[model samples]
Target chain A: MAAIAKSSFRKTKTKNAVLPYLYLLPAFLIMGVITFYPLIYQVIISFTNFETTHLLLGLKSPDLRFIGLQNYIDIFTAALPVENFNFFRVLEFNFWWALSNVILHVPAGVLIATLLNAEGLWFKRIYRAVYILPVVVPPLVVATVWTNIFDERYGAMNQLLTNISAAFLGNADPIYIRWFEDVKPPIPGFLPGAPLTLAYYAMMVANFWLGWPFMSVVATGALQSIPKDLYEAASIDGATPVQQFWGITVPLLRPAMIPAAVYGFTLSFNLFNFVFFMSGGGPARSTELLVTFAYNLVRNLRWYGVAAAFAVIIFGVALIVFLITNRITRATQNYMEA
Target chain B: MAVNPQSTKNMFVRIMNINTSGQTAGRSLPLWKQLVFQLIALIILASVMFPIMYIVTLSFSSITTRPSKLELFPKEISFVAYRQVLDRPTGNPVTFIELLRNSFMLSMGVGAAALVIAVTAAYAFSRFKFKMREVLMILVFIPLLMPAVGLSTPLYLLLNQVQVKECKSGETAILPFTECSDGGKGKLQFNLRDSLLGVGIAMTASALPFAVWNLKGYLDTIPRELEEAAAIDGADANQTFWQIVIPLAVPQLAVTFFLGFIGHWQEFVLTWLFLSQPKDYTLAMTLYNMTGQYANSIPWNRFAAMAVIVALPVAIVYIGLQKQIVGGLTTGGVKG
Candidate 1:
């Protein structure tokens, strides 16, 4: 009788163990329906000539002709027409913008966090709250405010620059720069009387301003968590502040830094609203990133299949970065342990 | 050793020296240096506040003035923009009131649904050890990493097929039901694209991962002993979860609900993609439409008014929930 009861009890326990997975089933099902289905559907659509009109008409199949790698090749090698935008230029701009974001974001985050973490810093809470204000604001509002700041005719930036220039040049009237109006010629002297442009550069400045605050907040939080004793011990050993920062702060902050860098990299790549609202990726297609480019392809041109292809490419790139960062961080942590 | 009357005084002096030495070693720099550092910090703080201050000023400025000439203090304070936004149209106009109603209803629906689903699932994940627990956790992280823009096209395609069912005379029909005819009149059709349900579902999907992640963190921090004690007192798992775990998790639930609510309330891209019809537009989309197609017309004052109206409630809620927001992040960030 005892043996029988024990075996029955074990059976009940085994059944109970499966209950949590049952609870997880609904969420998994929803994710599968929403995320995984679309991912697979997109791959299938990429080979087809799906366009917006066809989508509206509910025409089941679009001649699924296998244009092997033609879309990808066209994206990378396309030329810009005088009146039309080029996909390749957009891709190139995306690469440059993502690289610049990493360059600015990581260093700026570390610098601000370090300043805040300085010894005898007064009213630390006030400064921290102020720094985090931008992160809480809506993206559209941020873009709007930046548009005002970057306005050519009546912007604060231009006004300030003009004043400083007037002071230095000893002139009553200052030369006004039309920041976003100029356009670069295709080739040097090939197109006569063409204007060279810095419109894309101006847009990048706005994006950097919006992105840097979140990076700083994340970095500051991580910096504060680093034990003060570690810095004190290094300083006591006759090390300068810079040496202590490099030796103790940077090494210990790597865990936090890795995550923030990955986030920054992904954000720069996927940033759409700011670019879409502020620059429209123009003066030409010089400021378009992958997200904006894909959006424009779908919304403007209605090339559904090609847009899906771009989306797939973006997903792959983001996945690769995420995986690489994860691997590097894990290895670093293991090395530290050893 | 020879005992001396003055030895006790010397011992007390030695103790005081040790205490003072340690205190001095750890004491931060002098007040003057601290003040200088603070002044530099104050300047940085001012720079951070500048853009927000400019927007607030512009919101109160006259609608007729150019965006560039707008001052920190409006020369003439006027509520023309606000009045225009609030005033009902002379002849059955679809005003900001309707837009707000739509947004509030949609946000609240999505938030409530997400909370119900996430809370139960979070409890299960936190309380039990299961075969696929780790896999489920990792799967939840995928949505966080994937950009919403990437999913827009695919979601559009899938949602296009979803249709409402109708039952009449014991025969189920999907509306607006259509049948192909050769050289004849075809059936009428209805589109789900402009419906609130479509936008709500999308919002819920986007908000789900964050809600689940946060709730799971809170659930983990709840001591298992409480549940076990309840069980010993003859309470079932359902009863224990409802009576004990639910109450304990209220603060976290509130935080997730607000975050999800605000996000959906201000969402643009998905709504823009799905709801192309003008009449179905949300408040944020309506504000966006006021600006030109390329957003170049610069409706400076009117745009600022809309922004202020939208931001006011959010800022108030944020300040009120400041402690919970910080506490939630402190726990969730470290754990996740």
Candidate 2:
């Protein structure tokens, strides 16, 4: 019996050693084709001055000479010609937009989830589903819907705003705000300050509407997973509802919060559909994101090498953000678990 | 530890009396408060559905009326805009039949392919404990983070090279050959740009990450004991997976499949990016085209009509599959 058991154990060990690799074969192959190959190919193309004309003429030969780091240098410091649009300006907007997305997404999600999780909240599922409706809707459809809503003349939003102003301020002279128009107007109630362009702000509103639901859903899930006993104990110890939330809920929910926050930030950085469909990086390129800017360079303007450099920059930023957040969260996890 | 019977009866009566009085006091709260909450909820719901309602109403309204005046209900009903969008002439005049065929075929192909690849990959990730397993798991998310813009140039170049080869051999090129085949005329002989296959592949690549991640989460929740029990009963690993695991995961499989289908059905970026020719546009792309440049050239009524037609099928599918979607989310949420 002992001899037979030993033989079975040896057989199992051998099977286990081979099984993992065998199972991983298909995943690795798919990843290689879909992800790694394109990645390597993109890095290679960044070295060359490949463009639409070159591609069309079958000039993408291996014999093309490499220009070392010129593309990267040009991307950072290169100024646009008088006839051409500035590329760095687009990158700057993308950075600000992504930062703002994190600011809005995380808190909005937390607040909504907390409200829903409160005791005596009725019709929870209905509200949750209603909130998440935008997420299920296709990005194109969302963009199309908002385009009409923000229309200068026929838009529902403008009409509603006009009505409200008329009722409250008695000024109803068919007020129409071109949400995406780049023209600046004087600030109301701010000491006659210079007017600011709202093109980027309008796009951000549409994006915020599209993105907030995802954060809320994630936060709600995280909130539900917390143990009820902890809240009960807090209540017994004479903790106020607000105090319990800050002390127990926030700290306990961090594990889920960190990941959701990182996702929101990364998603904002790579946001393409919202900017593309709503603003089209229009009104003097005020709303162009890094991704959209890169796309315009390659697909529209035929500047392949420059676009590749921009892509590399975007990737680098994303990786740095991801790593820093990952390290912080992992450390927090260790602390909590310990 | 034994209690006195008389004391127990008295305690129960006291509890009942307290509960009845508390219920009465709760009932004394103003009915207006409940009405106020309901009113607030209704307003929120309306806000959520307002855009869709606007599109629906405008779709049925007359073109003579300005779009700004369009309300929740059409003043007069007409299908003129729908007819126009359906019969609108392209340079090459693509028919409604062709558009539907392209969109349906792309969605189905991509959905099917994604299901197969994601299921296998997810199963492997969930069941196996291997070296670099965690690293491989993270690798699955790379495509999600890597925006499509970054991949477009290389893909275009690669496809262009392949097209050149086909043109040189005097065979019908499989891709949109921008230069070699058309003698630099910028016209493709056999444009893969508008082909269902190309669109499907791009959609599949984009949707794979989410599908894999979701499926892996589902597979993890299933107990290992079931598989071990099957093995004890002389079942092979494959048999166990097919008979036991797959059967139990049917609901999840359905949800994933529907999500992939809907996602591909409404996909615009990839379809627009790959298929540049007007003749090869999908339904979403077609709807976008109806709005025209500067977004005002096309009459608002006609644009709304086109949007309605485009969104109707998706809305129906969403409502039909609403239960599955909600169930999947709730289950996945709690489990994760």
Best by TM-score: 1
- In terms of docking quality, how is candidate 2 classified? acceptable
For model 2, how does the per-residue alpha-carbon lDDT over A224-271 read when each residue is reduced to its tens digit?
Answer: 677777888897899987999899889877766666666666667777
Query: Model 1 over residues A1-338: C-alpha lDDT tens digits?
Result: 99999998798687678767666667667667666677677777666567765564332645445566666655656631224456555665666677677778788778877877665566655677667666667666666566656677766557656666778886656445555555663344531222224655666676666667766755665675777788778778989888988898888777666656665666677777677766676676656677877787777776777777778787777677667766766676686687
lDDT computed for candidate 1: 0.66
Superposition-based RMSD of candidate 1 using all C-alpha atoms, in angstroms: 8.8
Q: Write the per-residue lDDT of candidate 1 for residues B1-336, one digit (tens) a residue.
A: 011234344443321111212223355767887787777778777667766776677667766455544255566677876776666311235777787887788778888778877777788888988777788887776666557777777767667655543333333334324323232323324456557787777666656776778888888888889889998997767788899999988888888898777667777778888886655667777666544342355456666677777766665666556545644653454333
Candidate 2 matches the true fold with a TM-score of 0.80
The CA lDDT at B103 in model 1 is 78
DockQ of each: 0.23, 0.24
What value of lDDT does candidate 2 attain over all alpha carbons?
A: 0.67
The share of true interface contacts that also appear in candidate 1 amounts to: 0.31
Candidate 2 clashes: the total is 1
